[model samples]
Target chain A: MTTTERRLRTAFEDAARTIEPGSLAPLTIPSRRRRGTWTVPVAVAAALAMVLVGATLIGDRMRGGPPPAQALAAGGPQHILAVRAGRAVVEDVTGHRLFEVPRAEGRYRAVAGTAREFFLAVQTTEDTYSFYRVTLGADGAPSRPRKLPGPLFRTQTGFGKPENLAASPDGSKLAVVGTVDGHAQVDVIDVRTGAHRIWRTPEGGAITSATWSQDNRTLGFLWGPKAADLRLLDTRGDGAELEDARVLRGSSIRSRAPGFGLINVFVFNPDGRTLTAQVQGTKTGDHDDTGYVLLPLSASTGEPAGRPVRLPSDSFFVKTDTTGRHLLQIIDGRPGRVEDGRFSWISRAADYDDAAW
Target chain B: MTLFREHQLSLTRTALMIVGDRATAEDVVQDAFAETHRRIGRLTDHDRMLPYVRAAVVNRCRTVLRRRALALRVGRVHEPPVWSAESAAMLGEDRREVFLALRRLPRRQREALVLRYYLDVDDAEIAEVMGISRSTVRSTIARALAALGRQLGENA
Candidate 1:
């Protein structure tokens, strides 16, 4: 490097070496993974069955009559993971967590919707099954676990794996997407009264993830082997509100997938009418160039109401604010851990490019 | 590793200068140390820790600055509406001159200068951290240097 370059570089180095610390205190208390300690013995088979029927019927009731469910044009928080002692603490937005649940523990059990609500969860360790009712406070911190009530599904232990945690908009029902033993299905649980309903998805397809809408009229899920497609369920309990759900298939995850998991960015616009998602591109470098699609909430079957609108963000889409005005996305190319707190905001239109810098 | 006893004050001062907020700067500095702690083994070469710490601070500054801008646009709801503590008391002329010059510059220019002159990041690494093409990173440094030269020149 030239003399001037060396001087400039050295100057920044000296200044950088002398930085103070962040004003906001970090989350430093080490928490133990003691979540799954609560389990009221429910016959495993019974719990599964109740979840199946309850999800179908309750979701139908909440659907408020077959409204076309929208898609998350720019997705919300993908995965809620907590690390205790360098291991992921199995927890959700609600206070409930399958603490100490192995990395991939738990059967097809229903839990609360997001970090916002609290509900029930079931985890199976080998032959033993543990159930807990997780309560979340207004502050979003999880409360102590209470054993789940009602008859558990009578089935072989560990039949299904927890896929997605989606709740009805009314906060009444939560859909736990998982496999029944080896069968792909969605288990529904009622929050206010502790009821269970489930729908056996014969497709046995893997549910990549799911998101609930603001209307509570629909639940959207992505299910597939490698390519993920969007599916909607009527949480209103009226019927399978599966009309107009579109699957943008074969999209490659081209960005740094940090804490977001290998998730397809599924975001429900704040207006609660539209859903947006990032379609992975073929060539994987940065998802910045990948396409996106937006689907509106209208109750017409066979394909989503609108075309998938393309977003111009260069990866790191966090969540959409309630107003739908600003889009939060992670800023790319940093030197910290993959999950380093780096993100930016852009207007739905004219938003992603220079604003990212 | 640059031992804390030797470099702590300098790191704190530089962070304060860039962020223009004491508490935030301290936090940034602490975070830089924590990040260093995590990567100490990966750094391989002990001398490289300084650059890594500098990069971390620049990135943190960008984060805090972006957060400030967002809070402002979001109607001051997320963060409490108040001037940062660093600017609360009146600073002497030299500090104020530096602060005002920084505040007047565009975000990228200030960051480029901070990384290039303050943090002492080489152009290539700065380019990587900032997510800009190297050429743009270089241009950003050039423009920032020219502006700083003029700003400091006027006072001289």
Candidate 2:
């Protein structure tokens, strides 16, 4: 079977296991009079009303309040770096093309960085990814792609290429995460010097969505065999093992009470006290209710801290700017930004594989 | 009654993927069985009884969705079905992504996919269950696979 077919079968089997045979109620057939009668309709109507009222209460309580004003304004992030068909391109907030960052070889799989400074990962081989730095000039012209020397990142096939590059707030350190020999590895590179620090998951796991705290010493990332927990790693610590990283208290995707459903991507705000995450809301039957909220989680506890800003359906990525006022969001491969808690699509097509501001 | 007892769990689980919750799925399966039982005299071909009951379950799920839509239009909206905590625990993150992408598909596409993939039924059976031509089943499954792959960021 193909990957799609395999995934479909796996998903079906997993969902099926939720209803065990032993747990099922006894089967009883309704009589003829019970089916074609007014009494049945009346009973169903009453039951439906009660269920609806209960649902309304739950929805109201979980929806939370409107988002904060300053954090959502549209007028943030002067430029965005996006990867299209393995090449890097620059675009305005409205998604108008400015220019492409010319590369001689390799596909640009991931991107990160902020303001005029940006980093791109060019896949030089099947599993090897080389890093490069690009800086935007005052006139918005991108400087030539400059290769950064150090250990290359490894992105294996089964793990699905994640957001593996994160540039620190001061641009002094670059964190790269990927897998090698089935073990998760993170390499933090010092920009000024070619030296770097390395941390590895000794057993096995896949790491993705790495972000930097303002302190420049704390790196937060999603670690997985399950990849459900968001872990905070101290770069300044002596240990090179990933076990030393602290799993934020409530970061699991399975967090039910006071929790957000699936968080596909997240980034630290400028303050480093909170994280803005794209959360999938409670799903309805056969309805694509994904990407319902961009919620803020307390950095220490992993619990929700503030009101969640609603997002366009299927929005996955979230990039926060330095001021923590503006945000860049990608909905179903189309780039957009949130302003005043409202989402407006950039005029670009939905071809961007990855983008960052 | 024998057939319903034999296949109750499997059929109810199938309905769960279509309707999105356990309780409603069980109800859909039960209603299908009850309707089948009520009209057993008309089922002359024992060989095709399973497919017929499967079709009934699919049809009942469609009705449930239709009623929910109508309720929304008339300003009597119920809470959307959520995967229970147990269901969520059973599904992995990757499988959950697959389910979310599946939900985004059109109703017909979703139906065709569940019939072909989840049911593991052949094209002819899917056509019979969906009340479409065999050729339409093939095409619909093809289109559904491509659309689902695109949404999941993969090439079918």
Q: Give the whole-model CA lDDT for all candidates, comma-separated.
A: 0.44, 0.72
- Residue A128, candidate 2: Cα error in Å is 1.1
Residue-by-residue lDDT tens digits, candidate 1, A89-182 = 3432221343432332354233333334344444454434434544444333445555555554332212121224545555566666544454
TM-scores for chain B, listed for all candidates? 0.67, 0.89
TM-score on alpha carbons, each prediction: 0.34, 0.59
**DockQ, Cα level, model 2:** 0.17
As a TM-score, model 2 comes out at 0.59
Off by over 4 Å in 2: A1-75, A157-162, A224-227, A252-260, A285-291, B1-156
Q: List where candidate 1 sits over 4 angstroms from the true fold.
A: A1-116, A120-122, A127-142, A152-163, A224-228, A236-265, A284-357, B1-156
Mark the 10 consecutive residues where model 1 chain B has the least summed lDDT. Answer: B79-88
Candidate fnat values, all: 0.08, 0.30
